[model samples]
Target: MASATEGAGLSVDEESPVSQKREERLRKFRELHFKRNEARKLNHQEVVEEDKRMKLPANWEAKKARLEWELQVDEKKKDCVARGEDYDRVKLLEISAEDAERWERKKKRRNPDPGFSGYAEAQLRQYQRLTRQIQPDMENYARQREECGEDFHPTSNSLIHGTHVPTKEGIDRMVEDVEKQIAKRSKYSRRRAYNDDADIDYINERNAKFNKKAERFYGKYTAEIKQNLERGTAV
Candidate 1:
């Protein structure tokens, strides 16, 4: 039986200088790793505290109420539009003095002329156009009749006829314009992806690009296993 001192001596003798250096390196690595881990933990804690300090405090309840109010109003407007009803602007909350004044000014701007609207102005424009067109033709006809005498009768020969036929170039230009409009519409049209399998082609293409990498990894791992087996080493 070996005594304690003798056993200790044998163990120390079995350990080489290289083994001692390896043990020392392991101890230093453990110490370094522990310090690094502690530093990382401390940094993360500091970041969290900094974020907490920087975040501004707000009235969450009030914010939620305001957002909900806006949503409700938007839904109401949509409902009105869907029903083909006129959208009456409704105030959701009281406005500030400045906002109220701005709203009043906007309303006044909608009808710049106090008693007249855009429709009325358009009607007046149509009436003036008709008067100008009819008056000129009537005056010319009256002058012709006066010069020809009252007994003079009008015939188809007296009426001048005009014919306008588009040239081939003009017709081709118009067709090209129509084709451009059709192309523009088609360009902006969206293709619907309405099924789970709609993106299969894209997924397959992406996977194909990575297939070689996957095969290489598999080959590398198998090669390592084969080498280990030949060397009689445990995997």
Candidate 2:
């Protein structure tokens, strides 16, 4: 029994020639598999890097084209202004003045129409109604501010009157009030079916008032507006 056990235990040493040969073959197979996998990973990374390099030139060309287009437009504008054909303000202003006088004479030849008077009356009524609605709110706001106490100032050193130190609640209330006012005005306009004609009339009236005030305060810069408009083609 002991001889049989010893024979079983002495079968084959793993470090022997035959066993070592088999182990070396397995290790070679594993190394080949590992090298193939490493090659595939490197190939994939190279493809990604090549794609990134390809996009760079395309982006740079697009940016260069946009800049060139802007330059061309600017050059064309400069050439047009230099020609003094359409953009000659001195000639244009003289022509405009003559056209204005002709328009005035044509307007005088026209008689008063009943439809015009009716439309004017309707617009006046709408304006008066809106003014009345806004006036009370304005007056109430002023009264409340006055009643809030003069000592209630926004800054540490009070240099301005009618200023209130707004808390978080006060700011929230103000935002709500402004939103409500906007909603009310939107509803009012919708209900009244206010059209472009009403908007144009309002703009014209407001512009007239603004022009009067501007002339009073900034008449010295009257030529500046024209010069700036000529140079920049913007208001």
Candidate 3:
């Protein structure tokens, strides 16, 4: 009876050592996770701020500095004029070496590579501009190649160069390029000849068509009257 009482007094460990360790690990993990989340939040905010800064105009600071310099110069010119001194001499002729160098740098920036390094560079730029305008129609090109067959491809082997296979990347690029071209074409119209010999007496194409119909139906009856009116003889 005394041994049973002693056993009952020694309480049972409902949580084992392993479970205590696991609970401790879990609490540590939760703290680390919270710290990681805070770090990620900070990193995201930094990236957003960086993007905003990048979107600002690069030359804005330079422009502001230049404007400030101009304002100071204007004030100096006013003082020179008041003192009956030569403003041009004070402004231009009396410029320091630093100012001269700065002016040269500004001029260089304004007209960087005013002339081409070589004719080859000009040719390359022209070629690039032409190539940029070339939006490939793969389906049409394929159809043409099929029609031409050996005539265009110049292939003898049926097994080797049977047909040109397009990649998925190429197909997607063509689709995006075509959509861009369509968008560009929508914003543009063919400019008509400004110095046409024929007189334009209508406000628009529709008006021009209406005038043509009126003239066509009644031209014969009014022809003599029109001629007489032109000669200032129609009363």
lDDT of each: 0.70, 0.70, 0.81
> Number of the top candidate by TM-score?
3
Query: Candidate 1 vs candidate 2: which has greater TM-score?
Result: 2
Question: In candidate 1, how many Å is residue 226 off?
Answer: 92
Q: Give candidate 2's whole-model lDDT.
A: 0.70
lDDT (tens digit, per residue) of candidate 2 on 1-235? 9998777666655347788889999999999999999999999999998898887875877888999998976776687688755534544555777798998999999854334358778688656655655424565566667766564344676555535454586578668867976887687653334356532413565686687687788878776875786789653
Tens-digit lDDT string for candidate 3 (1-235): 9998777665445446678899999999999999999999999999999998798899977988999999998999899989999888877777899999998999878933346778998788757765968777788788877877767556565454565577797788879877976998777787654658876879988898798899999999999988888789545
Cα lDDT for residue 184, candidate 2: 79
Instruction: Quote the lDDT for 46 in model 2.
Output: 100
Candidates 1 and 3 compared: the better one by lDDT is 3
Count clashes in each candidate, considering only residues at least 3 apart in sequence or on different chains.
Answer: 0, 0, 0
lDDT (C-alpha) at residue 107 in model 3: 83
With a 3 Å backbone cut-off (N, CA, C), the pairs that clash in candidate 2 are: none
Highest-lDDT candidate: 3
Pairs that collide in candidate 3 are none
List CA RMSD, all candidates. 26.4, 32.8, 27.2
Candidate 1 lDDT, tens digit per residue, 97-176? 89989988998779443444689786787566545553234665676567666334757565423323455865786688
